[model samples]
Target: MVVDRASSTRIVPRDPVTAFGIGNVATTGPTTVRAEQQVSTDLVDHRGRIDLPALAVLFDHLGGLPYFASDPDGSPCVQARLAISMQGGVDVGDRLTANAELLMHDEAFGTTRVDIVTSTGRICSSGTARNVAVGRTFDHNPTGDRGAAAPPGNSDLPGLPLPPAIEPGLDGRVIIEQIAAGTRAAGNLTELLNGRVDTVDHPLGTGVRFTVGTEPWMGNVFGTMHGGIIAAAVAQGCSFAGQANAAAGRDYQVADLAICFLRSPAVQGADVVVEVTPVKIGRRVASFDAAMHAHDGTLLSRCSADVHYR
Candidate 1:
């Protein structure tokens, strides 16, 4: 996802969301735009709930429409841009709630802005983005239709790294790799479990399906799966989705996230599963919604997330 006239870069995970370099990550397709309610993803396996920070990305992914290629003829010629202003987020499970709305469009600039609200409806994050037309390819000059002019070159963009004044902690570092790439291999997830869990298969967009036994070390002061463990799973699921839509040779960044807790997951003898669905896919921004459920069909938690694709 090259935005404006920026050079290509990679993405890295910071804390909760995955980001593409500092601004953009390549995507599999174009932005998916709509104001419809869709099933998006399943967040059933998360223990208890996800944190506010992690959940916001889930929402952003869902809000964006799934990207698809169009026929060379008859499709409208237009530039699409997606921007998000994140309101505050709530802490449910280990994740938060991120609220945002799409802003207006500018034909000349080929971009749009959005308003992001928190669960409590507070403004937490906001930014604007610019998008220009990137023309399509065709054979024989395309008999029925014509293509937009190619975007101007962006060969002079500068490197914008994270503020040098800050550094990342160990957990934060692990989160970067986990989310920058897709879900860890089943063996990796099992290694993280230290042999205390078993994984199952549930394809068809269901992200992660696994079972964990109640172990004393896995318990928190609240007598359930520890928040860290739950957060880890949620991060893995969201990260996997990020990788799925990610363009090769770039990293994804999480811009915002929101999560809702439906129920407490049992720490002992219970299993959990995860599912992911995308919401929006802007040139520089991306979003998704996910769910975690127990084996018995209890909705343990729901999450939304937003990311800046680099």
Candidate 2:
């Protein structure tokens, strides 16, 4: 991945069709198209964190939300406080990997810096840009005067806090439930029931929860919940994060995902909880890292996934 250097001119309107360069393709070379397609595909998978440009795409598709920064044309663009970019990882059997994050953004310049991380969660590429709202005459409109203390569009980019249970419709909780419905849980599979929203807008972490019953169908020969069950639970949490990030307006597709089986659960009936951590909230892409654990604090499994916002 090639990250562009952050600069004031970078923010200036280089493209007229799109306002903030949110959809601006930064890297152009012999491999630009191939690399971008790869990144775009990867960001849409459920295995890992989404890419920066993908996030940029989402920002544009979702309306020109100012907190996300935009170019003079009102397209989403990174400001001084943050930067956006993409990174890649390896794909082993049954396992996926990638990384993403929010580096920095310029509140004054209306730009931000972001670093694309690899599967191991390391920065691989980076870039910077600035933004300004030019009126119809191509005049610079001071964006900071509405409420000096407020952010771009003012207020904390109005968003919904993640629900604790798998409550769809209320916030697309039904979709998660549908994904979990037919799936068989290990050990007392019947014990598993509908989920509930655990935390919304978590500062430390976020995700949903469900009650699993110790049923006979849930176990393999070892009499434990199958690894598939754990993986599904973790994946569901990641999906929840995507839905929450999109605010139920747009849909997200998983590009890639990675899950590490840590331990096997001894009991079939237990309160399973999945925690989602937002690694990077880019314009076209969004990433969420999640882990599954039992009520007794047993680390059942951990997973990270990236989603394409469109």
lDDT, candidate 2, equals: 0.38
lDDT of each: 0.36, 0.38
Deviating ranges (above 4 Å) for candidate 2: 1-193, 203-214
- Give TM per candidate: 0.37, 0.38
Give the TM-score comparing model 2 with the true structure, all chains together.
0.38
Candidate 1, 210-302: lDDT as tens digits? 334334334433344433345445545665555455554445555554444445465665666666566765557667776777778887767
User: How big is the positional error of residue 277 in model 1, measured in Å on the Cα after superposition?
Assistant: 0.7
Tally clashes: model 1.
90
